[model samples]
Target chain A: MKALCWHGKNDIRYDTVPDPEIEHGRDAIIKVSSCAICGSDMHLYDHFIPTMEKGDVVGHEFMGEVMEVGAENKELKVGDRIVVPFTITCGECEQCRRGNFSVCERSNRNKSLADKMFGHAGAGLFGYSHLTGGYAGGQAEYVRVPFADKTHVKVPEGLTDEQVLFLGDIFPTGWQAAAQCDIQPTDTVAIWGAGPVGQFCIRSAVLLGARQVICIDNVPERLSMAEAGGAITINFDSESVLERLQELTHGKGPEKCIDAVGLEAHATRSLDSVYDRVKQAVMLESDRAHVLREMIYVCRPAGVLSIPGVYGGLVDKIPMGALMNKGLTVRTGQTHVKRWTDDLMNRIQEGQIDPSFVITHTVGLDQGPEMYKTFREKQDGCVKVVLKP
Target chain B: MSYSGKTSSSMSQSLGTSDKLARGIGWFSVGMGLFELFAPRTLTHALGMEGKETLVRACGMRQIISGIGALSDNPTPAIWSRVGGDALDIAALTPGLRDENPQKHNVELAMTFVAVTCAADLYCAQALHKRHKYPSSMVYDYSDRSGFYRLVADMHGAASDFEVPANMRAYPPMWAEFTPEKESGLL
Candidate 1:
């Protein structure tokens, strides 16, 4: 099988690897049809998340037909098309019962290793890193899906791969981000980062009935996409996010804020961003918290801060005083993908939203290495890249 | 299944030729700086400029800073700095090339190496700049991509049917008085 393998920092390779086989009764083998390079995958590509080994297959957002199924897995059979959620869950755990699927207690096989790092292991994630169980990802011709019976979302016949593929990750992720805001009809939602997840966040906020939506990003292409999705766009490069947000919300900060940009927030235009870059370069900080600082400083008092961004390891200089005094509520976690996929899939089928709008580039899986660089650099108007495996 | 006729050998790498060159120069800069810092007397004696060890050490520090910058995620600025340092190196070496200096040939050789490295730095810097250049027209119009089947205006609040899960709700029961349903008398 040919897969995109992580070689090192900023190095992904199109390599030939052995075929995946079912390792458990709940496991299934999928012949992947489509996969995407997620923004969080950039963390691994940049070598930020620790525990990634050489030659690890690198992708999670994928959908395909089941080519083989385990005997005890009655939920699916051969020829059943499904989108594999990034977070592997056991469905029987207490967290899964409470709809907190991302933290399902039994999914992570390397729980003790993760316990040493995160205090408690959350869930086993596909291709994220060893801290998340180190399972091989779906950016290949085929993949072995552990706990496949409960970890899959069945795709209907009518939808295209591009329309349904994101159900496994970003679509549900963005939906979860907006849902966490508990958006009221009178609320104003301000989102940072107009990347793919950020784009979906803009649309999700609009769909869920926020009175106004504002998106902040430095990339013009992304800002344009955000505007199309009904967000008032702010280019942090040319104008002030804080000042414009203040003016748009009539001087009272926005009622809800979302940080879609996570660890590698672009280091530009602000003194804090420069400070983050210096700290990151010196290895003093593991994750950049520029967006977090900006969101906390500008959010309305007692407002909700929903974060869907991926942050690894320790972050320095968070404004704890402001966060405490303002009485803000912070909601953050990996998306419990199953909790929202059914609703989002219905929306897709009902002609409410099309996930394909965010895909700006598509190519063969062999071009995965090049596309990683293009997507990371945001070059050639590349907003998102989908690989046909 | 064979997805592509092209094999791994034919695939394009994330690090292009110029990027690899910049990395090479960055390491070379570090190596050169270390030599000048720890063994400045060796360079000074070779060039017949025995009393200039301190100046060599200072130049070494500059090289190290520039090298670290060159090795960073965006190497264009650091590469440009190296070009500037090359000019300084040529100026500093010119004094050692005087007719009275016994090791003027070694100084000339060092100047030649610096000139070659300076050219490489300039080329790499320009390539990186061009690679990272933003599009001249700031915005690429994606206004048509509303992601909705109907007009975006018509799609606003389309998913009002969605109930925020109990654990995720922002406001308490007392705050329901301010809800849109209550405001519109629908409650």
Candidate 2:
């Protein structure tokens, strides 16, 4: 089996690795067909994520055919094409039982039974780093899925690989982010970071019935995608994001805001000072969307603010009191991939949502490095990049 | 055949006798460390917050001296995001902490160290900085040694970048170094 790996910062290579075989009774080994470069792959490739050693396999989002399944994996079978959820949950942990499957007990491979047994960092992730668990990522030719019965979301036979790849992580994430909001009928929604995840959050919010959808980003193509998704778009570069968000919302601002952007926001890291860190943070954070906060500040005092944006461990200051005082409800977490995969597949099959609408390019797995470079730069119409193995 | 026989490793490795006992002890130590670091409110009933802080402060300096400890760790980019993003409610603070009362921050290695987001970690950082005030950049960082990567994978636009990996398997708790070039796709 061949795997794409991150040798170091800006370093990626395709290397031959071993084929995956059944290791746990609950595990499933999938023969890879397709995988994609993700925003996090950019983080890993660029080295913003920290904690990785050299030659780390650098991907977790993927879908494939089951070549084998452990006896415990009764629900799955050989030859079933499925999307691997990014998490490795046991589906029985307190978190999993509560629909917080991303933090399941069997999720991370690096963690020994001595560790929480499942998760890394906040919980575990595939091929992320040794800290979480040194589990191999899924950008290879075969993947050994832990706790497969809980994590692998089956893709319908008729659907193309491109249509459901996002379901593995992004679709569920976006939908979950939308569900986190207290989206009353006719409520308005504002989203930051018109990146792919942001784009889906925009589309999914509309699908979930927000009266108005507004998106903010500096990228033209992404803003165009938001516009296509029927969202009023804002480019924070030329105008003031705060002014525009306030003006557009008739001073009440949006009823709910989502930070689709995660940690390495769109600030000048290499070109600027350490202060660039602050700028990128705020830039990617789309402070105006904290209108989730402002919704508390400006809404009818009973409005909701939902944040699906991801954050790393041990974050610095968050205003917990204002969130409390405004009588606002703030929701955030890793998406429960298993909870929605079936429904998302059905929706895709029904043509209600083609989660793959965001994809812009498809290339062979051998082109991963260059495609990663292109996609990470958001170039060549690369909102999403999927690689066929 | 065992139920886990469906899992994908042929190595047939299982926990060793010593490994199982060590695992128990490791969990106990981890629990003790968490209690010592996080449960000062409870631990204080037995040992006291003052004692814990003193011990933490002393041990922190030793960790620094021994090259394994640090007085301050780089806040994750997420924490930096929360602090810088106007999303942070500047008003919610322990009185004059946010760039207001310089004295409350004076014994620390720069007042900004107080800016970490989570209250629990802030307390930890505060106790250490209040004592030795070492200039080491990160008190802790994300790191890992046991390597794991899935042989196959998929992702989509709706997904986030950094978080999805944890959904699959345990990862190292340490953070990876940031690559500015790779981030912007310049590389």
TM-score, candidate number 1: 0.92
Candidate 1 lDDT over residue span A257-309, tens digit each = 99999999994878888988889888999999999999999999888899999
Q: Per-residue lDDT of A1-389 in model 2, one digit per residue for the tens?
A: 78887776555777777776788899888887888777766667656564688667768789999998899889898899898887677888777787677666556555563254224434466777765566678888888888788778877668888778888888888887776664544667888777777877876676666677888777777777777676788786776666777788787667677777655555322222244355434544212223233234543344555566654432333456766665655567777788878777776775666666676666666667656655666644557777777
Candidate with top lDDT is 1
Q: What is the DockQ of each candidate?
A: 0.45, 0.01
User: Candidate 1: lDDT over CA atoms?
Assistant: 0.89
Instruction: State interface RMSD in Å for all models.
Output: 4.5, 20.2
Candidate 1 at A337: error in angstroms? 0.5
- The CA lDDT at A345 in model 2 is 77
Counting only residues 3 or more apart in sequence or on different chains, how many pairs clash (N, Cα, C under 3 Å) in candidate 2? 97
Candidate 2 structure lDDT: 0.59
